[model samples]
Target: MDLSLSTRTEGERTVVVVGGEIDVYTAPKLREQLIDLVSSGQYHLVVDMEGVEFLDSTGLGVLVGGLKRVRAHEGSLRLVCTQERILKIFRITGLTKVFPIHASVEEAVAATD
Candidate 1:
């Protein structure tokens, strides 16, 4: 399936609303978006994946790369995802410790760590 991504500023954080599948083909789009946001100095990011239908290893890599980018600038990258399937991927990969996952965009934006 195709991937969709839209970004918006929420207070001090930028929220990237994502929908559809994020596999090898579509992961690059997400990687580019995250790179653009960080390059433009919007480091504090929240990737809202509630609309995400599927996520593969490549997508997880993109997220990890985004996290690394933000962290390099002393910024943060959090995730807004409540899907058990998606969450399971993180848990299984032990990425739940690497990234802070929230249930909502608001919670992610308000988080301080």
Candidate 2:
């Protein structure tokens, strides 16, 4: 699983662009990175997943976990998922209700406001 993260700060929000497969092996790394960002007091997080090719339960867990953490801090988390397969996972797991899904990174970032 290859992962690359790029962060763009806008106001009080931070959009983290994620590119690569998000699986059990790589989910922890993503979780850690997100946790670090949240702990740093950057609560509004947008995960850009346009480049992600795969995701498993671990990846979903990471996103859910981050959502919980952000909510606890009175912050928010949004996702940009365009892949049908990945979108299906969220739908099947009923996570579509838990997260605000965006068509693109720009939309996700704008939603943070």
Candidate 3:
């Protein structure tokens, strides 16, 4: 499954809409996008993962990296993961407690406020 990523502004926050599988091969794309966003001073991010089908350890790592990147700059990184499979992965890995997971992009974007 190929990964597709699109980013846009939602008020003051940036929303990254992701689709398809997020494995080792596709995780780098996500990582680079996050890096680009953070590097350019766009720290408030909402990763809308509802369209994501499969997520692996590498994907989780990228999310964690993004979280750290934003936190280091006193910025915020939130996730919109309504899928049970993806939510389960975060819960099992104890990441649900680390990342702010929301039901929708609007909610996630509002959370930064």
What's each prediction's clash count? 0, 0, 0
Most lDDT-accurate candidate = 1
lDDT of 2: 0.88
Of models 1 and 2, which has the larger TM-score? 1
Rank list by lDDT: 1, 3, 2
What is the per-residue lDDT of model 1 for residues 50-90, given as tens digits with 9 covering 90 to 100? 99999989999999999999999999999999999999999
- CA displacement after TM-score superposition, residue 47 of candidate 1 (Å): 0.3
- Model 1 scores a TM of 0.98
Least well predicted 10-residue stretch by lDDT in candidate 1: 104-113
The better-scoring model by TM-score among 1 and 3 is 1
Quantify how close model 1 is to the true structure by its C-alpha RMSD in Å: 0.6
Model 1, which residues run further than 4 Å from truth? Answer: none
Which regions of candidate 2 fall more than 4 Å away from where they truly are?
none
Error of 3 at 34 (Å): 0.3
**Model 3, span 1-113: residue lDDT tens:** 79999999998899999999999999999999999999899989999999999999999999999999999988889999889988999999999999989999978877744
RMSD of each: 0.6, 1.3, 0.9
Mind giving the per-residue lDDT tens digits that candidate 2 earns over 6-108? 8889666788888888898888889998999999998999898888888898999999999999999999999998899889999999999989999987777
